[model samples]
Target: VLPAVVDTAGAATSKTQVHAEAPDNTVFNWHLGDKGATEAAFKAARHVTRLDIVNNRLVPNPMEPRAAVGDYDQGEGAFTLYTTSQNPHVARLVLSAFIGIAPENKLRVIAPDVGGGFGSKIFIYAEETVCVWAAKKVGRPVKWTSDRTEAFLSDAHGRDHVTHAELAMDADGKMLAMRVHTTANLGAYLSTFSSSVPTYLYAPLLSGQYDIPAIYCEVDAVYTNTAPVDAYRGAGRPEATFVVERLVEVAARELGKDPAKFRTQNFVRKFPHQTPVIMMYDTGNYGASLKKALETIDYKGFGKRRRDSARNGKLRGIGFSAYIEACGIAPSAAVGSLGAGVGLWESAEVRVNPIGTVEVLTGSHSHGQGHETTFAQLVSDRLGVPLENVSIIHGDTDKVQMGMGTYGSRSGAVGMSAIFKAIDK
Candidate 1:
């Protein structure tokens, strides 16, 4: 165990380092947008609100934990691995290219009957790597399955941040600018997309649903003695939303206005809205959504409801939380520029049988997102076939075409979108 000799006063420097390569336990440092523009906005604003927020860490506790089995085909001189990975092709790529286990074509990966993976099973883990290596050496199938305790010990964790944010507003309460400084705890190692999440995913989303004119963000990714951090559920978008929306609410409270009204007043009211932080929202009706929510919740009757609850010896209060996230798995070229190791595209192949049945092959390995029913529906609706006539095939790289796999809630967006395009072709 690493000695606990760090100072509590200097929280940034005192922690015991987990990796020798990362001295002082720093993983990455990243920034975005113009600091000058942010400064000017703050200087020109009539009001400024500051808040510090911490989005607590999470362990992705899927029903069935991570598992893998490896075997070698002696006749063909090939290897195969069956694991509960979200992206088997990416797993194949890492095992072949980076891990140096074998060449790409020589490896056949099958991700069979996985129970669930809420963004945690999307990486190449060490146990599976060792199993594959050991199988070739021992000339037998090597299997490894993680129990709940082992999953807690080994699975990539998510969303640990200590962040400070400031929002600037004009005299009329229109938002002018925003700035954020976040220290992200990346745990022990950079698990797959860990280096990119807090920077590319978090910073660009600092604007949230608001129409802030200028925004600047900085993230200091630090390593600690814990499981490596990675994408969990909404990943960085949730953390970014917490900071921006909390600021919006706190600012509304400071200026003596309804939180809903304040948010609606600053809503991005145009198509192709671009935030200073590197995101271009093509189309949205944020004001309309807020209006519908307020009306549905009966915002005007809050006082009466609170009084009634107090009479009954209870306390009641309404909360308004508005947020926006950039989903659709992002753009490949755009993310590539931001230093992503892989592109952000999914793959699919539609095989039409001569007997009028259909078999669809996709890169997405759906443990619990219902790809079998959903992807089948996509083909059924498009090809004019009955749902039963279409069968979805995935998870096996030897059978399915190469793909980026699923995360960021992209199974419907990019994965199914790829299947739709394949149908068109």
Candidate 2:
């Protein structure tokens, strides 16, 4: 069970009461209170059958780190930033507010040739702000790139969570209720989306593809001594999937049932099924995908293969993960209601040049997602113009007036959808 840190001593008490300070030298008298309270409630109800705990830590290995460069024209009162960014215009707006910069009319951000962001490039980093501030300071262009180790300590990390998951199933191997209590590590400070990542992004995905009738999840986002944890690749979905899949596997083994068969029986077959969480899933064929995967993997013939491997003194096991994800983010209002500081809407403008050529500017910035080619392909296909004639431009705040940068696989879905609409006009 996950133990939540409820309280701690504020200051120096005594020599005997003094414990070692955290890695960042933040010292306090530590106390562990309200530990396992959720688990206790579950146990008292007799609804909890299986419980599992998983703890994750941070890993910072930097090859190509973050870098940003900004340019401002004192004459035109405009600004531009060329750096690694997931969303440049969003960075411009946020940095403008935080740094007490001039109106957004005087600011522009450009994300150019970012190598690898993972999830690090998604934030409005201090380095980006410093560059813009320094450019005005030095009266020239300013560039700052994160070294390997700076990226480790400064760049936001991901997936530091301690989770307690419980699954209740009936005698005939049907899941009745699933409950998850997670204590998410928010590090020393709250980063851009740190608070929402664990609660809205992670916990809501616990429903997976199961047809369970009742499910409840609560997340306690707490401060700790480490880098802020945010989105990484699949972000919260992967952790949620891992917990559900692992628990399901263990439950199947305990019930002496074939794992695949158990999952097949519990698959959600209807459309627009609503989970106990906030999400209402759209079109999906969970059973069809599971059946197709079983056929491709030859699930019935696995026994023969396992026996053959046993003869060779090697234990063989086959595992399956049937999961569903919520991608493309959501409507701006939908995400804003969940405590998001900014809107999640994307922006794009298609400008037709005098020669009937096209310039497509988007709020989404692409480090390695190939916005130049893919966006051009989309324009060419839609406008019936030559691919070379359609130039996709992004990462400049001046070019695209407003934007919500890319993350949560929202670039293609939200950003591209905006581009398509603009081009159609």
Candidate 3:
């Protein structure tokens, strides 16, 4: 009945019904760095700019919608769920342990030819759980596939955040400190990996290619009467980039400085720069990258282009964005320290057949990322084998013992590294 209460703004108001007993609808409050110190520094800074970024919810429209088929084998006392998932092993684990669908040994999850996930298919949903459980009760195979309309209405959405960010700068336009307060919308219920998305996944990356001595971020995750919100594409990193870049751009404008120049001056120039946040960036060349970008885009000629466009009553403007992301997800110890419950490492098995053909089994799932070709090429290069002789297998829990899945663009960095280690062994 609460049709209008769809966002965190509404959920925070008294008119909205209390979904959970938590005060102010806050699921958790996550902060990084010293907020008090950053605020004190902001007071003494020469220039400070406050920017509010409102990112609306987005439903991922993958080429193929979610589909599931559940079958129970009576004789074997086992269940099989064929669903479109990014990680079948994780799905099997969640369904087995948390959902009580079946014991891990008695249940199998297979995700084959998932059209595209873009992070939406990573989490376990109600339909798949229902299908698997119903199959056992009815003693028959249960099948369900979401149509385009149903997919839009039901699929886990992504990136609904309201952020108030401030950047403090010195007289010379060098960034001194930054502070951010974000209200993240987790939708009606918490999805798998939901809590991490707005917290550890977000605030840690606030230092986005910048070398601010002091930075602080506080995120209040709220529940609203909306579809479950989760990761999409770049996930939390994209949102962080938006906040940082926007603040930097506006700060440059207010201080009457060149955007690119301002970014260059503030770019993390040194290696092994330990940010006040949790992230410790080991290496980057942001200044050189910006120089190359300016050259490639003909940045100096933008005034002429703008003049030409205005003569024809057109508005033309170019903007710059400096962003950084944390890919290659794990080393379980590091991720677990950040509140991740499961092991973050990916697993792979490499087998050289007696016929000289190679079979590589990985926990990483690929919808449109071309893992088959890339992994096959890698094996061919590493082992001196023909491309056709190498085969990559994935997306089946029964076949691959375990996987941490693919999100945060970790497949190439983490998955391939695991494959390389397996090949070495």
Cα lDDT over the full model 3: 0.88
Candidate 1's C-alpha runs over 4 A off are 5-11, 330-342
- Score candidate 1 by lDDT: 0.85
lDDT of 2 by residue, 140-206 (tens): 9998877877877888888776677788766577777777777666666667867666667776678
lDDT string for model 1 (1-425, tens) is: 64742221233595565666777777777899889999999999999999988788889998888888899888888999988888899999999999998999999888876877888988999999999998989999999989989988889988888888999999999999998999888776679889877988888888888888899888888877667889998889988888987898899999999888888899898879877877778899988888888888888898899999999999998777788777877466457667654768788999999999999999887887888999999899999999999999998888985987888888899899989999999
TM-score leader: 3
In candidate 3, the residue pairs with backbone N, CA or C atoms under 3 Å apart (3 or more residues apart, or in different chains) clash, namely none
Off by over 4 Å in 3: 1-4, 332-336
Best by lDDT: 3
Which ten contiguous residues of candidate 1 have the minimum total lDDT?
2-11
Please provide TM-scores, in order, for all candidate models, with all chains considered together: 0.95, 0.85, 0.96
The segments of candidate 2 whose C-alpha lies over 4 angstroms from its true place after superposition are 1-48, 60-62, 70-79, 332-342
Clashing pairs for model 2 are 79-108, 81-110
- Quote the lDDT for 120 in model 2: 68
All-Cα superposition RMSD per candidate: 2.0, 5.7, 1.6
Question: Regarding TM-score, does 1 or 3 come out ahead?
Answer: 3
Q: How would you order the candidates by lDDT, starting with the best?
A: 3, 1, 2
Clashes of 2: 2
